[model samples]
Target: MLIDLHVHSDNSPCSCMSVAEILAEARSMGLDGVCVTDHDSLAVLAQIEEGFQPDGLLLLVGMEYSTPQGDYLVYGDVRSLPSGMDAYGLFSAIKERDCAVVAAHPFRAWRPSDIACVTCENVAAIEVRNGRNSLRDDRLAEKHAAINGLPRVAGSDAHCIHELGCFPTRFTVPVTSSSDLVRALKNGQCEPGEAFPLAVGL
Candidate 1:
């Protein structure tokens, strides 16, 4: 299944796309699913869970946690994450939960310590192809993932409508829920993939 693992809706202060617009774009682009990872928020996810299901496209709720080290794409049980916790704290907190964490855009102004965290087993994957990242940054992230033997995932890192399907994570099996996605990531059954043809110029 093709899923964009990182995306922001209007719930994110930096994103201009509404939840409805994101769903429409994802469906039109032929994506099987999308992870709505708004920065440090889950209000939109709660809204969706309440009764906003879109036919044919699975919506997974996640959060882009801003730690002192860097951002992490956290899937499953975000309720335990405390505000401003560092990467180490995050690793320890989710170690016992059925969750997966991916280092988001690792080369985006990353420090040496931050790069080291990508190798941690606790971090299930790395964002090798971020739609908003430069080619150099993406290459560096890809190399880091290879060197660390971590699974690679891609995401639009989208903050607007046009960026919706620019990059996606290809899953070997169908994942209908957050827990399923986390398990797939943890088991290394996914990888980064190209952007949709329609999204090439964006």
Candidate 2:
């Protein structure tokens, strides 16, 4: 299945797309699934479960957690994580829940220390391609993932309509829920897929 493993909705302060709009766009783009990983929040999950259910497009709940070192795309429960937690503490808490962790845009300009965090044992995958990242940034992330022997995934890191489904992680098996995605990552059954060209200024 083709799934965009990182996305954002109106629930995130930085995003302009609503959850309904995101799902509609994903379906139109022929995506099988998308993970709604709003920045530092999973409040949109409830909104998804309550009102949005489109056939042929799976909506998985997740979050982009901020740590002092960088950001992580986290799946499964995040109730144990506290704001401003450091990388090691964040990894330990997520590991306790057996959640899936993908280093989010590790080579993005704002977080130079992300390479160190991505090398940690608890990070299951690294985002080798992010739609909004520069080519050099994506290549650096890819190189780090290769050196660390970690599985690679991709995401749009989308916060708007045009960015959804532009980058996705393709799974060997169908994954319909957050748990299924976790299992896929744990078993190394996923890989980075195609990404749209980066915008002019992004």
Q: Candidate 1 lDDT, tens digit per residue, 29-86?
A: 8788888998889889556762125478888788998887878889988766777888
Model 1 regions more than 4 Å off = 50-54, 110-113
Best by lDDT: 1
Each model's RMSD to truth, in Å?
2.1, 2.5
Clash counts per candidate, in order, are 0, 0
In model 2, which residue pairs have backbone atoms overlapping below 3 Å? none
Worst 10 residues of 1 by lDDT: 45-54
Q: Name the lDDT value of residue 78 in candidate 1.
A: 78
lDDT of 2 at 31: 81
- Per-residue CA lDDT of candidate 2, range 73-102, in tens? 888665456667777888888777858888
lDDT of 2 at 54: 51
Error of 2 at 173 (Å): 1.5
